[model samples]
Target: MKKSTLLIAALMTFGTVKADEGMWTLYNLPQAVYRQMQSEGFLLPYRDLYESKDAIKNAVVNFSGYCSGVVVSPDGLVFTNHHCGFEAIRSHSTVEHDYMLNGFFAKTLADELPNKDMFVSFMREQKDVTPQLESLGYSRCGKDQQAAMVDSLQRALTDSVRQIDPTLHVDIDPFYEGNRHYATVYQDFTDLRLVFTVPKSMGKFGGETDNWMWPRQTCDFSVFRIYADPKTNGPAAYSKDNVPYHPQHWARPSLEGYQVGSFAMTMGYPGSTSRYISSYGIVERRDAENTPRAQVRGVKQEVMRRYMRASEAVRIKYDSKFAQSANYWKNSIGMNKCIDSIGIIQQKRDYEARLRQWQDSTGFLKGQLSFPLLEKLYARRQERVRTMMYWRETFRRTNEFSTRAMQLATGMEVKGPKKNAAKKYHSFADNSNEWDAALDREVLSVLLKNYREHVDARYLPKFYTTIDTRFEGDYTRFVDYLYTRSLLMKKGAKLYYNTKAYKADPGVRFGQDVMDVFYDLNEGMGAINDSIETQERYLCAAKLRMEADLPHYSDANFTMRLSYGQVKEFELGGKPSGYYTTPESIVEKMNRAAHITDYEAEPIMKELLSARDFGRYTDKTTGQMHLCFLTNNDITGGNSGSPMFNGKGELIGLAFDGNWDSLSSDINFDARLARCIGVDIRFVLFMMDKWGHAHRLLREMGL
Candidate 1:
């Protein structure tokens, strides 16, 4: 879990990678994006009226939807990604009737289905937590140890608010990487309900093949509404009696067409991307890491997909798993495409060139920092980097039993009298409630055996998984020892998982003492993480690297980040790139494949065929439709369903995916093609109104 990578260059030569003006640091936010945000009305409403609570709520409330929706009335009716609201959709779906397949609509308020554990984030306010967080000195806290400090600080800060206003919930988020933090207070209304969605054929549109591609055609949207209790103000489960939330503002959809370079703000939880990483890391990831991983995943997907087509039972068993794997498979390929793209690579070189130019002019930075330092550092660690990559690819294994064993041993430490320790332990136990104790034990046993087979022999001398142990020892003994000892802890252990074991254990008591030996083994592993030498030489170096790079990187935590840009006509690979798109560009690509006729009916196609209308979109130089924007907004994966808002706060477009050419742009901002492609809000509205005949919904929003 080191957030940063170490790649260095020498002191005098030009490095392959560089950071430049085009790569605006988030630390200098006030000078760049925030200024645009303010001009565009993106700053939270009620900036001064409410206390810190108000500011936080404004942010949390304004959070963009992951699905497509519109304000049906003065009330907030947000639309966003269907897959974004897939869980809510599934809650109402049935075996006899798949809502996702058929889609759902709310004929009246009474028909909406309420969902549990579904909440929206509204930003309340932001404050400097630097001093408070810094109180936990960095020297005293190693990279791994900082998680505890952060948790404690967050809990303490959140508790202060809860004591005063029980309705408020707090979540801490990091911006500009881990260098800064903010506690976001939310009016967490769990009473979220489904309004309507198109059938899979319409909602999914293109399917997997066209998912992340563009110049697209797909109605990738769904509708959801928030419900709050009338009297209590607390979030309530869905009920016909509940009322729709009255939002601060709503959007007016447009169809007149907007020119490129319009100010845009994407308000959503963008998943992470590594926009700030060492150039050396990018090379390794592209040429060696991602390419290979993609190959493996691609092979698996093909075999599984073929099996699903050939056998119904096999298909049913593996369908979901395949879908999950397909994302990685597709993403890997997208990344590879980006890494190999000449346009992207040129941008990387350009950024470096700019840095060199700036260093020469700045004078103060000339000798202090240069591109060569990066290259030299990276060169020195080439072997170590490869070794680590090998270990990651070949040696890592998630042994359930080992994890459980560690938790069980650590459970004793929670029994201490300290309030924080007890509370922390209690929370940990609560979170583990979903785990199946028996299955976990069994999985652990299987995993250990698998690890022995998969790991390389070269790593054997360093620690466990040695060939001698495999030949001389009884491996299952370790497994049995864990189970037996875990049984004892269940007797008096207050932890819920421990409690479950007590009820299940037969209490034969044989070999129970062996649990103590397993505990020692667990401690030995912990020592690896806690060792001072390891902290200084490896962990600390990684931590510093991450801190230095975060300002320029995007978080790829599978969350979401919005990349804002207009469609632009450009030249690439000796050809005019006029909004480059392929047959595989539809969101419902599978459907297009299934029904070729659908492509003939697409709006973009219709325009293409009706040369007079569509030709208007052609760029002057590239002779392609321009979908371009210029702004300093950062984005990443989870930001897919985010709404790209213009300066006036009107919905301009729906961010769907990034171009394949700029995949490495996440690690290094490559403006040439790193632009976020969105289905123009005009398009979303056009589909809903013109295509879907949702005029009533449109008029309600005063459009």
Candidate 2:
């Protein structure tokens, strides 16, 4: 695409889209970005329940559940919605003490100190009494103008929160486009310890592999206790002597399950999503971009994950990559399943049918499109399918390798052009905290070789194919340069001594002449080549798409927006599947689907099944099993750990996933099909009492 065209596309996908539901405007968010975040549950808390403005001011939390917590006792016993403690729980677990897989319970306050890095954050107060916001004027401004007005409103609100509570952290979020912005305040508290967590078999249960899936059986819950100083009544570290926090409001943990249709609200921070997009945008992403890209990446991730699991060598070498890749792979699997789900297709059909009728009645989009023309465009693209995929995959893979190399090179150059760049090699020592110079040298060598081998040659189009850089004058010259360069030898080695040090070293004096000769030329050539390639490819794709009658839309960029819906189950695969599946479903699946682990070995599930008085959990509204509860709450990626609460302010469930039918819920909400799923609080309580055996935690809450 041309630079201008690419800029326009980015603006449309990232900067401009919004979610609109009939007369109810969700927010200006692109649909693709909206669905991605929505599926992840990032839109749950339209407004969170913070005690005061001081809390929001000191909160440094962003992206991954920074510091949101609950006050469980009159002494400020902070309670963070579980999941904020997942990693910490896992970290403290082992074969003997599998806090994650087997779960943990601190019988008393002293016992809770074992789980490290568990924390709770509190924002004490908030104040937003601004006359500027109260005053309204004619709304004739453009979207940007309106956005500016909202920004001003939010800043004022944040200022008020900070002024009222200087010690707390504050952030102002925009909601409903420019309609409203609230100053969210948080009290930052870090000293938290594990109070209890059900066994991993129950807590994580199905694990990431089954996360966000239905007919799903995972408890996905945990608990942490907060401690504070007796004298100050302020934040304190988790010392064995520290007293339990005295909180104002404590959530009554109940064994009461929610009904099928319950009135519940989610209180937490939601990330961001974009539900505002054109149909033209949707077709492009679903049909052209994400599906194919995800497929390729999915295969690679799966293969790497499998190898990592089986081979200790591969596991050690790629543990970091493995950790990073797991979520993406799991997400791809879920997204693919969701995209292919019957509900999503049906929803799309229903939307098209509605739009078709509207188009017929209103000339808003008549004759502007022709089905045959669109088909022709598809046919043209089909001819070059292989090339497109190859280029995309090559770019994706090489981009990763190239970024690492650039950072490494930059660091080396900054350290000075040493004989063999020894200073640069030491930086790796710092990064790994491994002072073994030998290992650092070996690893750096391996990394360079790996980058050269894995990174596609096409990525270096300027240097490899074109005779622009002397480093790539020919294959022989390339080989010789590698051998002679400091990258391949030791500081005292003869090969290193002869080679010119890295040019434009910025600090080093060694290779000034050599570096000066090639620095600008090399850098300028690379920039020009990349720019040309990007422009050419975009223009070519655009021309073809115009012929094909299809317009391409970029992938979903994370953005904040609202997605509206209600909680309800839909008929699929010939069964009335509720929006959530319980531990019961999990046990059944473990009996049927677990590849190797025995069903009986998972004590948490066993305990759940064996509970004598499983307790008559009731939502009072639907009166269903309530293994999982559904809500009309709008959510997306960032809302995962949010607490789903009843109107009377009881913890109901943890917002987890959306129904498959709601995959397109971002573009257009279909209340008939879309539903947000959560792990019922009843189940959480059951696990806590029966499996986690955290009675002390229960007693502390007066449950």
Candidate 3:
């Protein structure tokens, strides 16, 4: 069948949810789902819950467009994951002042440090525009044509919105596999500064040891503030004269303790989920997509971990980079296990059988050409998928130097007809000064080793065989040789770029070779991906048709969503795990893991927790400080640092991680097994007030 025929085959990956199976858009939530949430203990009115002037939705902002954060104090003090602000902290750190190891706390306005590009986007409004897009005849349009149509409409909407107020950041986002679209409006504040942060010992507490594992105690919270132009009280770029912003809506944190049966709600941008992808797609991911990522990052993480453990300076240098690398490394491992352990693929196959029956009964397509397109498309492209994934992970992702090389080639292309590096041309390149010689060399060698071992002979760069034959596949020698001769290495240290030096750099030269091979593979893979994507979108539209009148929820696309569930526990390995943990656990875990730097606690934190200094923030029920809690509230990647709210919409905790068992839920959610891990608001108070002793900030928060 022609690819155009598959355009309507998709809606979502599975049947519509009757209960807690959606990352719901706050603006147009189904009344049925709202009532379901109310029955489950949510007390907020639907209007106040979503569309009101001062709704809880207004309090949450997309932090730097990468993670979710909440406005806490009226002074625009923002709360998000410590790991989320890892870049800002890392950039400011040095061998002399190690903010990553010993956290920075701003006691006064002048003490607050400014970040250049870090900014927060508050989505002021969202309006459904699916009907408008449908008017353009989307069903008859090709994929590229459809994209162009959507882009044109989106640009017009953004321009009109800007005409009213140029300060507003406008973006039109697609939902339900582009079957639905929304014009999401935002007010972006460019001035953000460091307010306060607990030490890594407190913020990163259990570290990678307990990353995705439950029964957790990690105070994964950080504090930042938005600064506005003094006269206008509006968004502005970084200025020493700017004052702290007073937001229209900020969350009122409640100290009320919650248990297994209490209601929980999360409002933030959840990154993405294939939630309704086909069974064949599941198989492709199970075998191809996830495994290579684990392999490549695992190698890079180990080398960095070793060097970081060896020195405090190296630890400061690579702490944030390691956290970013190690997060998905563990996630890949957990997700792969969950896929098999839960028999998710088999479940998808079974559901597809039901879908077939539904199609027959509903006469959705008249059962023509729609049946095995998904299966056959993936089957034909499976090898290419693996090849592309491996090439992507190994060359594009793993080798940091590869991108530096790509910049060199692209800079030359932009030079156009000049054909010479001697001419003064603007090369817009950023070489991060965060690199350490030991870490980068080790990472490059390992990535090159994997690329040689795994990628197809034709696709593999010629430089790989050169290293193998000349150096006997000794990655260490090859990297050492490459770095020693490369001027980019020297220039990269000073964070400067030289066009001729970039072209001559051996690292960039090899990077160019890798890119050449990649471009060739990507050219062929491009056609396959186009066909597969068209099939997937068509599959989603067809599923929507099969369901007809059911309440369907859109897939997550890093846009704001509201997910609700109760604070419940589930059995793991025949053991019924409890939903809460205490400060006592941190003390115990620290002493036991003292040998590992990641888990090692500061002497002061240990002294206090060991002394049972629970203070006034202690929970009345447990009579101990609640460190963390578990809820069945559905969450994913960008949901990190999202404020977890009680029935009254009071901030109670910060959603941080998901359990290992539910990792497969991104593709298939098992409501019983899927649980969101959060750091209790009371725990944050205790750490900030008693541990850090920032009493002035406490009074500002009305604690």
**Root-mean-square deviation (CA) per prediction:** 10.3, 11.7, 5.0
lDDT per residue for candidate 1 within 311-430, as digits (tens), equals 544443443445555655677778777666554455556755664565466453334344565555555544433434333332132223343334444443345456554233322243
What ranking emerges by lDDT with the best candidate at the front? 3, 1, 2
Q: In model 2, what is the error at residue 393, expressed in angstroms?
A: 9.5
Off-target runs (Cα >4 Å) in candidate 1 are 1-29, 32-73, 135-140, 143-145, 174-177, 232-234, 283-292, 307-321, 340-567, 572-634, 686-696
Residues 372-452 of candidate 2 have per-residue lDDT tens digits of 344344444432343344334433332222222344433332344556454333122212211122322333233333323
The whole-model C-alpha lDDT of candidate 3 against the native structure comes to 0.79
Task: Count the clashes in each prediction.
Answer: 74, 66, 11
Model 1 poorest 10 in a row by lDDT: 11-20
Query: Which candidate has the highest TM-score of all?
Result: 3
Model 1 superposed RMSD (Cα) = 10.3
Q: Give the TM-score of candidate 3.
A: 0.92
Worst 10 residues of 2 by lDDT: 426-435
Minimal lDDT window, size 10, model 3 = 7-16
TM agreement with the true structure for every prediction? 0.63, 0.60, 0.92
